[model samples]
Target: MSLPTTTKEYFWKELGSLANLSFRESKLPPLKSHEVLVKIHAVSLQYRDLVIGLGQYPANVRDQLVACSDMAGEVILAGKDAGSEWKPGDRVSANFCADHIAGETTLEIQQTAHGGPIHGVLTQYKSFRPHSLVRIPEHLSYEEASTLPCAALTAYNALMGPVPVKSGDTVLILGTGGVSIHGLQFALASGAKVIVTSSSDEKLKIATKLGAQHVINYNKTPEWQEKILEITGGRGVDHILDVVGALDQTLKAIRIGGWIHTIGFLNGTAADVSLGNLMKVCYIRGVNIGSVAQFKDMNRLLASHPEVTRPVVDKVFAFEETLQAYNYLQSQAHVGKVVIKVV
Candidate 1:
């Protein structure tokens, strides 16, 4: 049994944007049988959090829903069956799926994403389960580790799953956003050729510095997918990280039997139909943010990958400047992850 040291706890609450989030004091819930009291060190921003705050992301879990996904923290109080890997002082990262503890990511387990259907992490002290908290890799600071639970892990599942990519495989990464950035590292470290595209040549240049062998400024060539086919000598890419979303341009972008991870809708949500092009080019698979089991699996592979020296942080904002970070993300000016520092 644990006792509270303070009568009130600080949490962020926003019923809507007109009333911007404010700090509220609340009492802690009783700890569950397999939960730990975690003192959160950092909270990560996500598109879904902004959507939820704007009343765009709907959830049955009404009001008082905290608004952040990824977090890093230390265990404070451990439950009886919380197990051996976690202790009072262990530094850890929480998975987006608070319920998917480990092993295979079955469909049921994969459905529990944070900051929407479940309570979010924008608080100082949160009750975490052993299933949700994974120990941090030794090389990363809490801030760096905090960004991986969703984006990096999703890219991992897209590239490093049961399928093995070899020295000469080709991957086409669309855009310079978080998913594409992580995808670039995975492709480079796995000995695959990477072709990265961006609307800005300047951003493409930066991605090239990050090990992209070929860069296409889509702004320069509107028929950029044709440029892709030309660069690959009409063979087309073996894999395409189509974070481009519902765009039919990506449908024309891959070789037959090649795989495409349909992760986000950054380009456009509703694009023209091209069933023939999609069938002729390749296969498409939708990706969610991924699971804790997947996170551990990917971490083991990534710990050894030379290309992933660190998550490329375009900028870091102070904890209080989280809204600014969100606005910057809205601007789409960065080539990689924009982080917030919380302590």
Candidate 2:
């Protein structure tokens, strides 16, 4: 028996630019037996949000769809059969792929991603299946927890998945963006040395403070791969988190028998790599975020080691200023996650 009836939400009215987003108020749907109504407190922005806003994502680009995947909220109401685990006042966050509870990912599960193809949590309130929501760490505020689902989970999966990173191995992170920053934190937690690259000396200095053992200025050293080889004594890095999709540089920078996780395309979408380069690495795995089970695993790790895994939020915006947040993201001035606080 909840008293709140109407909710305010942002919708992507057309497939074009950020200007197409529309705001409106709607009546909250009747909660299903297995549903929990969440009062969204904060949402985080991702690069994909920009692509989705620009109508560039390959799938699930629908008119009037909600436009964000990461959010943290409190459970305001729960249906009779919602489950014993949930109650009013419980803080939670939604998984990136709502249907991926456990096991390997499938096309069906991938298609159910929030934001682009599905209605997202960019609203004041949203109804979610209990299985799709997980409890947030008690030590983290709603804003901090909102940065996890996509960026943090992707980094965690890259480090802890099939090819697990280990102590003493060196990891090369491409930039100072959300995913890379999270990767740097996880790599440090795994007891691995980190090498982060950026065009800015300032961001590199920040990365150094965040525990990166070495920072390279890619703009200053256009042939940054050569510098990586020089730094590693020609052995190259043990793992390369290829956020830039810079295949040529990645090929040159990864040591033989190392792993490379392809996570983003900030530099370019297409590239040619030598067959010789392919033979040297363990594998080049393409990382989408992760499953709900993986999300839980990440949360467990975060709870145990809060110091090593705090999300770096660059700026906070009011809920009405989502467009400004998007513009800020487009400017690429932020070093970490951009967040929106929804009161």
Candidate 3:
């Protein structure tokens, strides 16, 4: 195949609103020795992407930067040193942290995170170091695979990280967004009993169908932590995916020595932490997605359970409707991932 000379991409021409996003054609440079050029098929929206676009993310973003992080694509060209394992037509997803292949992520690794500090994958074609990409599961479509880089992997790491959720453990998932739903799926597949909370009873019904053992309407039951205790025979849950940043409530709902994976800040970032509540002896750990090695491990599990582990895509927008996709994500009406079909 002949290499293309130019590509179309969406960039944050200026920040503060989705309207600031501009689409333009630009030169597609030749790949370096260790680089692979991917034809992006789809990109998934995350809350952080919206935050960054609004100039609210606490990071140094470049001017006129390309938009999002999570993408699924076909490797259309690979430079000679890009590794023999990658080739044209390989379906792949880029890791959010380009250089954090394994082990603990450092400040340097975080700097390379896509969408904010660096140019992301919201282009028709993008170049990447081969090490930054992972072969996606064969059973997943480009839309489903696109959701894995951030949401699915964050859920996987929250459940299967330092302290893994095992069969028979009880887990509490906070909402019905992409990460929460993925956490529900992962926990259920691990044989853990899952309790999901949402403000909408309608979304709660959907969570029930998705295999949650119990559901809580937080709007109806503001002190849902007490209900969690009642559901768990007064013992509290073994793991809590604290997406809402409600530390006080999580501290109340956690079991003795339980794990609380602080994954999101939907409510707000500032939360009053009580040292007295710390006496519950629960472990509070913040999740920063996962490494390339962890992503490969998650894909193996997804491959093994192809029938059950598909990502739930709420809606898909065309390449030209990228702004609409961002607006829809901002609206937060979608239960799962909102995708952009770039191909």
Candidate 4:
């Protein structure tokens, strides 16, 4: 738990690329009264990290910002005030937006997001305030815990926050990415019927094994909405976790008064918001990554029910292969979260 004089870290040194990222040795800063130093063991890859690396994300990050948001590690050092709350060797996960500890997210809170508008935890060691870290569940390994901060938390917010999915209700999750897979798990745990859409029939089979009640191959069935309505006996699903953000299709898939939780834009970001389409649903909630309070709540659930709530890590790269991990995520071949092992 002793501090090192210098730590190795990766940074986004230029815009519009991830090809030439280089590691630099930096001296550790003195810990503040409210801070603890983390020896990051693992960091998970998120799509937003890709955009931030390209300098296309909206957050006003530093010129050479560290390039990731989700990380899990040991609390290696704790300052005076933090000592009571955190101790050396405690496993912890970093919050996505450090200042958004609880309550609703705001523009100011969004700017404090890690990996963008702030230095991230893709380093051997990083320091953070107690409020910005959550102790991970004992059952989860550092790699598994690393997957929660962004993808899992967003999925939890979509399913459990704002409008909770109820038993006997049908929930639709688009694609087999990290968030969508987690959504499928939460929906099934809530006793709701799950319908997952994927372009790959193989991935669809995997989704079925993960407890998705129905699977749609959107590539073969161009009009997946029709299939969804058919599956529900023309009633449509009660909740839709639309990670792809297929606007027209999302508008078509929900039933009257059903909730559509828009979590990501893997398909596309911009779409013409048709007023007619908007009127069809009761709510179209936009889900951010979620607050630290939500992350703690999720960890509690994961602790109690490890079978249903654990993270599904698709692949792990060595810390030196961080760039390749991002490339793999870009290929969209991963079924769940991709991680970088930094221990």
Q: Whose lDDT is greatest here? A: 3
Q: After superposition, how far is residue 60 of candidate 4 from its true place, in Å?
A: 2.8
Each candidate's clash count = 0, 0, 0, 0
lDDT of 2 by residue, 193-283 (tens): 9999999999999999989999999989999999999989999888888888887778878899888899966667555577877767557
Model 1, 1-343: lDDT tens digits are 4655432222236555614655555677877878888877776666656566666554544466666788777788888888777778888888888877655667566456666666667666788778888887777777777778877887887887556556899898988887789888888888899999888988988998898999988878889889988988987788888777735676677787777778854455665556667566466777776667788877776678734547787888776777787778777898778777764
TM-score, cand. 4:
0.96
Per-model lDDT: 0.74, 0.89, 0.91, 0.87
Please list the residue runs of candidate 3 whose C-alpha ends up more than 4 Å from where it truly belongs after superposition: 269-276
RMSD of 2: 1.3
Model 4, stretches more than 4 Å misplaced?
A: 269-279
Each candidate structure's TM-score, on Cα atoms with residue i matched to residue i, is: 0.89, 0.97, 0.98, 0.96
Encode model 3's per-residue lDDT on 4-117: one tens digit a residue: 889999999999987899999999988898899999999999998998889888778988899999999999989998879899999999999999899889999998999888
**TM-score sort, best first:** 3, 2, 4, 1
Model 2: how far is 321 from its true place, Å?
Answer: 1.2
**Alpha-carbon RMSD, each predicted model:** 2.8, 1.3, 1.1, 1.6
lDDT of 4 by residue, 1-343 (tens): 4567778999877868877566888988877778998899999999888877776676577778887999999988898887588898899998899999899999999888888888888999999988889999999999999999999999999999877888999999998988998898888888899999999999999899989989999999999999998999988889999888786787777888988899765656565568866767567888998998999998877777789767889999999898899999989999989999995
